[model samples]
Target: MVNSVNKRGEKILIGPRLRRLRTSLGLTQTRMAEDLGISGSYLNLMERNQRAVSAKVLLRLSETYDINLSALTSGTDQQLVGELFEALRDPALGRDRVPKSEVEDVVGASPATARALVNLHQRYTELSRRLVREEGADEAASALQGTVPATDLVRDVLQRARNYFDPLDRAAEDLHTELELRRTEPLTALIARMKDHHNTVVRILPNDVMVDMLRYYDRHSGRLNLSELLPASSRRFQIAFQIGMLEQRSVIDTIVERADLPTIDAKRLLRTTLANYFAAALLMPYGPFLKAAEALRYDIDALAHRFGSSAEQVAHRLTTLSRPEARGVPMFFVRIDIAGNLSKRFSQGRFVFPRFGGVCPRWAIHEAFASPDKPLVQSVEMPDGETYLTVARRVTRSGGTSSAPSQSFAIGLGCDMTHAKRLVYSDWLSGNPMPIGPNCYLCEREACPQRAHPPLGRALAHDERARGLSQFAFAPDH
Candidate 1:
């Protein structure tokens, strides 16, 4: 579909977006204007939506910041539109429904106001949830309940930073350059580097001795031990992760310091998280990886084979392809266990994960486990109206021996509908996307047969005369 062109032949004015990008990078209006070859007053007008951004200025912004121009402007509205739709469906809104056209007009004409509306909706939803919970809690317990979940805090830290740490990316890139990680035998190179530089010998030990551990380092003996059960790709990753811990300590420490994490455990987790990211970046250098992904149409298995990495590693790396100039399709990568516990999540796209409950069972992430090792692709629409094309596969951790325990989880990689055509999996999909929700508590879908709980702010109604598909039927707010 062609984007609508303005009188100046510019494709829509994303003024709030330009302002956001400039502020995100801590750039002044004057500095941004100078960079874009425009006067400060003109830039101000553009930022306020009084003046549309020309194609030339858009090109300059894209080239200068290494940003995905389409994503900056066009991809900004789906989430807002979705949230607005959800808000309008609230019982408090009564039977008078707000039209989708009005929502679209609000998003297009004044995106800042639309964003503020979304924020207010989110706050109202959250406050309603808390109010409901507090009604049942004692004074002291209710006070304690206000503390944020550690997962929520970590998520916020990653989200606010857009899941891309420039310093870490630069460090990984520099390390890749210095080590020449894109060689015919990159794993061998990494092993040699570990041995020669870090004085750490990488050993693959059998499962019996290394029980209950995937990878462990004996600091005193200068040995990094790995389980024999691990596949070749995992073995290589463990080695590189150890290298990151040893060599990239300062970089990881600096990042953790900058995060101002709440607790020691959060710091430790962030450190490990940074190391894992560094390992992925090292294995798949951004430029070559991005090129191969585009060439292969982002076939996860193909890219994994080309890069000599695991499917999970490749999927996770895809989410990190947020470098300004060389961005890939914005994606959300999540790993959920069979029991529906989210172990890992990162999104350049705006797929919201539930903070306080299980993910909606309707999501393919949970179903992927039924056909272990097989990839299942689906087009899913959230209750609010945003759609995504998601690919999910179950990954297993070996226990070396058949009798030993193995852990399994499903990894999901998804991009918004606009980018789905680029993926090979989309060929089999047809019709509208399956309607799903972020979670039961946060979901306001009144008729979802799979809903496990009533949505926040919507009170449950007792009806002897009628039974609905959902167990927790809600009545309109009085």
Candidate 2:
């Protein structure tokens, strides 16, 4: 039996989790207690958090119910707490500061209610944005048309799945073995597989012919056209992605069907996203990749070279390493353009990304643009006091020409401080972490020199006589 204390030595409180599990199984406290060889009163006390769940009880619960221990102690609660913290920071709430302890209490008692509150806030935010865009449009119209964007819907779906798709990973691993990708060059092998299995001819087209497109498939001609500009890694990924579309359609469809998305556009977008996931898995099989990542201390460049992939591909793949038995470090990844527009974001842990607006300017991701191509490491602490080790670097897209320059984007990869020591970048940790928050609106940190906006729900303290380093200053009490 594993002890109730987590790795950090914090006592695990399973009250809410225990109650939820019992309710989910439709078992009464008395019945569950009898099954676990415990008294009903003791069970009630455990559910109410009046007592800590014992190691023996945990063992019995697992043995009796076939429960995974980690499921009860996972960081899902922390993720919810983070989301709720951000949601309550919205100015529209018009409420004074709600203590973080109260928020945790609510989550501990009823996580579902906390999640519903977050969802309600998200819907309200979307409707508010629509109203602004429409300029005093009818409330009914704003409410009706303010559905979540397909991209956001897809992001939520991926987040709920922890960015790992077991079906896709298994299928990709099987295909990788069948193709003997370990022994053969991946690009040539994948191209040959496309030709042999799908009867699709692969052709590399000139810059003038292909134009701006990197990869184009002509279904009528049964030909896959790749631009001459794409590097070997990208060409391989494109081919593998095409193969996923053709071969893994059923698996992808099953996953999408299970998703039960509201819009066809979202479903289509999810299909494309899943295909991309499959391509990444094909390029770097899960078991082997996890082993190699551990061995290499998650050096993105080293993994890219070893797996015949780009640095971006390798970084993105790191977020999907969430296998229960052979899991790698749980990390969050985000990609942003030079203008600070976030293009891609994923988290396999408790780190929460802002649903609306730019991230905090103090984050190291923004600093990556200054030293292009050089990786910068920083230990950052969130407003909630959670520390993370962030590694940021700039990566350029392929197909750049003298006439048209390729775009460069910053990639940010980070893991919780608890797991930071496993990363090679942790050597740069100085113990003194830079304070960051979700964004300017949600962040309450005072005197942030890089703050772009005043914190939501806080009154600005403006004085002509004296000015602080930041453009906006708020009341200390606020």
Candidate 3:
């Protein structure tokens, strides 16, 4: 039997748009259910595009929330297709049995697979990193040795950006004056231009509106939806992006070019990533921001208020302070959610993340979900005996901010012990080690039960669980 289907373009937008609306009203699945008289799962499926947002429900949303019909319809786009493709490209999909085309077809036609696609893609990333470690031994060795190699920095810089799209950045450095950033501050001036020139909009939507994460950018319409409740630290970063494109467009392009990304998609992502970099730089200009961070003791909130940034922004910017000549503090930064997903991550090698996933759930950042907005800091050590400091706080993301139900998620941030000392917030790290870090396979903690895969020199305990110090005993990599 032929399956009745809506246009692919329509389905994509409907899902995210429904998500945006449900978030705006601060309605949860249960809450939205009570209002729309629909089951939570059904509402979820609809918002996720597992179920087409039916005309009847759409009408109710438009009527009840006074949402524009066009906006609802506008949910359809190429982004979902891109996200799906990105997921399907995952080398881990069905352990490699499923072909990319098959995954694509299913993702385009079946909503369940679309959801599943994210997991499959994340798995792919994990596996690929493993392969990179094994095959990229030379690169890894070079990274550890602090020796510069061809194309190595290229990968790191691109990865730091998480491969997003931004068209304008460094190309305009000389033309900074053109954008009014030449004589003035790049970051501050960039923000001015974003508001006045590109029609790029920045609005701190209510905290309740966006529950889970820090920043959301709508490239189609050029809108930056920020969480109003986010610590001043992060909001400022988002504001910078809004301004950066208008001011740093040329600079962004230069970075994108020099980076020499392989795919158009990667290039696009890099553009936005660099723009974000500019934004953070503006709030905490390299030199002064570093001085304030040092003086304030890296108190993220205080620094945030000083620089008008959010915790996430402050964490990310801390990594950029590594410019050798005027380096502020050299620290690594990582962001992970309760689901154990490392959504946003960057490290200075001073703090190492697992090449894989399933971070130590015992960490305070993992617990941040229980106490939103409160920041947690801990000093920890690697199996190699390298000590580091970790800072964590719960960050929220809002789904269905338009008319459907919405939800929230939290992530963790961390770095090294020495780096922590440089941070205004390092006072918490003066004590003993904490259970903050990634899981086995990547983390060489031989004692962890969450070791989905054993670390490099570990032997399977087999029956040793009944007798020894650990089930799977690990030998040192050295």
Candidate 4:
């Protein structure tokens, strides 16, 4: 727990968190300053975290807004410190020899730079891992060899765009307000808007008529058609997405243009992705959703019920709560099929998604299949020594008929352990954390019994007389 004041009677600095809380409540610095009986400049400095909030101001903040004091003052700085420590340990960085005080100074004085360095290190790790894996494989032998899949390329484009588009988020928020969605049923309101503003009618077509098509818009008839195979939530989502394409096309296009994707397919995919993102933002307004998430302790089922969404949708939305002004917990989300193929992934944390192949089988996401619908929670430590709290569950997609094929995928959501206590799933955690890695070939764990391949660039020692705990033993790098 953070103290209200330091031993020297100095106020605790919580500028960034204070700013986030104020912004989440839509309060300006001047108004918040007046409410706290302080000067606007002082409030500004506090918001920037340049100065600490005095005990009096802290009490006033808690009383006035019902702020979660502990949440407002914790986790972020510690997370930065941990990431910096991990990044400095990269063999390529050679920063292990540098004094720790200098690294701490860098983290304190310029956090953005520290974060950038961490991102660079992750990219280095990912690219190095990829190159090493492809060293000897023929182009035909590897699908990822000569050409990057448009999916991977599109993912990189979105990552470079930081997974948050200000214009699109703002547009969605504006639509939410314009439709007066808060007071009424969002689906009904959106339907009325589609009929009134876009002169388009939504029709849910039977499976026979649509036949494998989930959604299609007939421009000539000004009609939006959706297959009945989709559930009610997916139906509403498709309608909302159509609204995004029809109304927020300019915003989506502008963002896509700015992305400067390398190919036409990538651009098209990005446009569709941005439209879907806008739809989700419209469905779950940022400020309200974030407030509800904190108030509900990030209960996924509760959030889904409150927002009239599905569990997977809520999980995906949690990863997008990086609006800067009203940020939520930084999280990483991934969806994978039973065969261990990554269908989708996004990260707002320091988590590294596996880029080369199937993830390590030791991950709990795979184990989640045993119970089918129930969520399995785990505390896992990465090879780099950072711990994360993760929850995984299976989501089933029905084919709307016994003959049609049904698909099931596991969705995983996690965040840094520093923030885990705030989640309901944390209560179920016990015992030591499990050790895991992104992928086998790239992981350098010395004695992992599950390792499938030796790490690249390490020399293997073959001795008839000796055996070790691990199947692969390596000579020390000189």
Candidate 5:
């Protein structure tokens, strides 16, 4: 009873929380007071915690606002505790006033203080980030004057451009009218139709003719020389890019300019990327495709058949279901070569997977390489106890019609387990099977023998017991 009633223990920073909630609810103190059946001054005092929130007032607010009191209270308190922790991270203060756990306890018990702390902490973080970037820029610029190398120029552009498209982005928008290509899937049906309409002969050329080349464009004769080893998907992409380079050069340039991309290299890469997007768009038009996916419960094979695409294509298309009019199953899609090289990652959903290097071996994505030709769907449980539903299959990558050897790649589609029921993979979760793994960054399971690298955010402490079962015998709690 004492702990529950301890006012000091409640980390209530209610003033900011009250103000935020009032703003969110679109209410002034007078209106809020009227709603609460209290005087405006009394309402103001309550927000400041000069007046304790009575049980009756709390109940009324909960009912009136259509919110759970515990939730509103805890949310604010957690935000506050986080701010306090961030402040405490700066070891300048001699900290003996209150125990950290007690401070956390108060934050949990009291809602108001937590909200203020979070708000304050966020502001501080932003200021700190700005200061660091500004300082770094000033010092670096001063150190290297007239001789700003190409690498430095690239860094400047990347820094200013936020590492995404610039003029290229605007070009993509402008090209929508000219090329009529969706941002994700860029190719038009007309382009695909031209193959039959114009008798566009797609010849499987010898790799020896264009060694280490993906596609060669001969605009004069309208010939698309694709490496024979390229997969069907690759061949189509190469052909469409050939079209983009040949016909859609203007649109590609517009996107490059819109994104503020450094041009000398942009002409080569951006055009190809936009062309592939156009091709993908052509295969899976947003509206009809997403509708089909929802109707079919996001079945990859069904989508592939409907679009005349490969399983890998369907998985890739799953990333772009973000259109306002049409949305499909939102999942993270990845493609990895047999050598474990990450070829592509299409992720726009909530989660942020690593952008560089290899993924955790323990992840089910690696399993596709082992069982080529077999499509698999598995319910994955990460080392950190996070479970995910993953759909994986092995796909072969060819160098087109040429003798360029094809390399096998594994395509994986996954979503958080909480979102699994919405997918067509619930059936895979019912049966029990051995989990195969060795994911370095994704696995949090300390006991995993296959973990090649420690998870990015985990810390390990060396324990006296040397014969632990896991690879890194150190023990640390997240």
Candidate 6:
């Protein structure tokens, strides 16, 4: 039964995953079947999706090949499928209509080819933007020669690792324990450690003195200056971040090296990201934080208060609790600005954010802008019928001056609905979940007044004699 249906009560089909695993292990159908004590014909049928993988077969596969059951059943392929579909839907491609089922089939059959196509499309899009912005032929030719953007490369690295760096986590935890952060205030302990270990003096400067920089480490003066604009939580985080840069440089560099990134900019960005991860781990050590989260029923405010972190920090940290031995609920986190741009995203779960465009307007994350600083909860069902419990709230970053206005963004955190009962926010869940899509260009939801663009590959259905709730209508059946 476990292999028969996923948490959403839908029949699970892991043919691609099973075949990929077998291929990775260098096992033929007969060999793997022998290992699992199943007939070769049965294995072939399972690999071809002609037969459902029984629980016994799943357990046998896990026991024999040493695979995580979640890895086999998770919706990881959906991200690749969605990205490939979006890439093929590009107007510039000028290809005939490609159905989503065909896209999924392509991913299932040959994920490597699908990923290559998606990567090519990304490069093409980046080059196209550069061509639009710059008129010079030399500049346009240089743009065409550019590889994937540094940001995208760094994001791909993080996503591939599932945002969890075990070595960094363990190192930060060890440091936290050695410093006895539990006995004293985190900021004070961090400051003492910085002064004692690194001979760095932590200072808070006035807004005028710091000006635009939130944090600046003066190497010659041995002073780490933090802007007065930062709150207590931010100051602690910045101090920890500096400590990480000094202490964890080797470990961060090793990780970046192993990632085999293409450009210097990508390496630098990844190093900073890893340092931020180390900082969060130092503030909220994995063991204590995971325990407190469970005790508080995954309450964001409670966890933030307990760890002396901000809501956004707490949400980001939640996505990194993917330790094999002591795992927390798998979750996804995203940050969106008022203009509907996704500034940040990380997932240790099945949910995938749209790669190129804005998110679905119906998502509660957008509604959080209306009631800033207050948390909003909703149960949302994607077009694939997978449901998730999402929590969204507005977080503000102060500029500390009238001339420099503050910036506000919506922070979204979500997990599969199956894990919703473990969260305190589940109390707000409604029986009817809001139906949403990845984005307007990919969504086929009809009569949505919030629909900003007609779905790609679907012909617009215009009739002067009739009007509907949506301004741009399309054939849903298409």
Question: lDDT (CA) for every model shown?
Answer: 0.79, 0.86, 0.59, 0.79, 0.60, 0.84
Candidate 2 lDDT, 1-478, residue by residue in tens = 4897878887777898899999999999999999999999999999988888888899998999998998887654888998998998764455477778889888877888999999999877755543423212345233533255677668777877888999899999999999999999988899899889989999999999998799999988999999999999999999999999999999999999998777788899999999999999999999999999999999999999999999999999999998887889998999999888888988655567765577788888888878985799999898889989999999999999998999999999999999988899998767699898877766778788988887655788888898888899787762
How many clashing residue pairs appear in each of the predictions shown? 3, 0, 63, 0, 58, 0
Instruction: Give the number of the best model, judged by TM-score.
Output: 2
Question: Model 6: runs farther than 4 Å from truth?
Answer: 1-147, 475-478
Candidate 3: minimum summed lDDT over ten consecutive residues — where?
163-172
Q: lDDT by residue for model 6 over 363-421, one digit each (tens)?
A: 99998989986799999998779999999999988555687678989999999999999
What does each candidate score in C-alpha RMSD?
25.1, 23.2, 18.8, 26.8, 22.0, 23.1
Model 4 / residue 134 / CA error / Å: 16
- Residues 226-296 of candidate 3 have per-residue lDDT tens digits of 87555443454556566676656766787778866554655777676677666655555565677887788
Q: Could you estimate the TM-score for every candidate?
A: 0.68, 0.70, 0.57, 0.69, 0.54, 0.69
What lDDT tens digits, residue by residue, belong to model 4 across residues 1-478? Answer: 3467866766677775677678878998999989988999999988776787776787788888887677654433657777878878654443245556767656655567889988987776665566535222233224333245567666766665567778888888888998888898887888888899989898888899998888999888989888889887788788999999988898888877876655677789988988889889998988889999999989999999998888998998888888878888888888999888889987545677755666777789998777786899999988889999999999877455888777888999999999998888999999998998877766788688888888766788877797777799888889
lDDT, model 6, position 376: 94
lDDT score for residue 110 of model 3: 48
Query: Native-vs-model 6 lDDT?
Result: 0.84
Report how far off residue 326 is in candidate 3 (Å): 1.5
Per-residue error for 467 in candidate 5, Å, reads 1.4
Clashing pairs in 4: none
Count clashing pairs, candidate 6.
0
- TM for candidate 4 is 0.69
Candidate 6, run of 10 with poorest lDDT? 132-141
Candidate with more favorable, higher TM-score: 1 or 6: 6
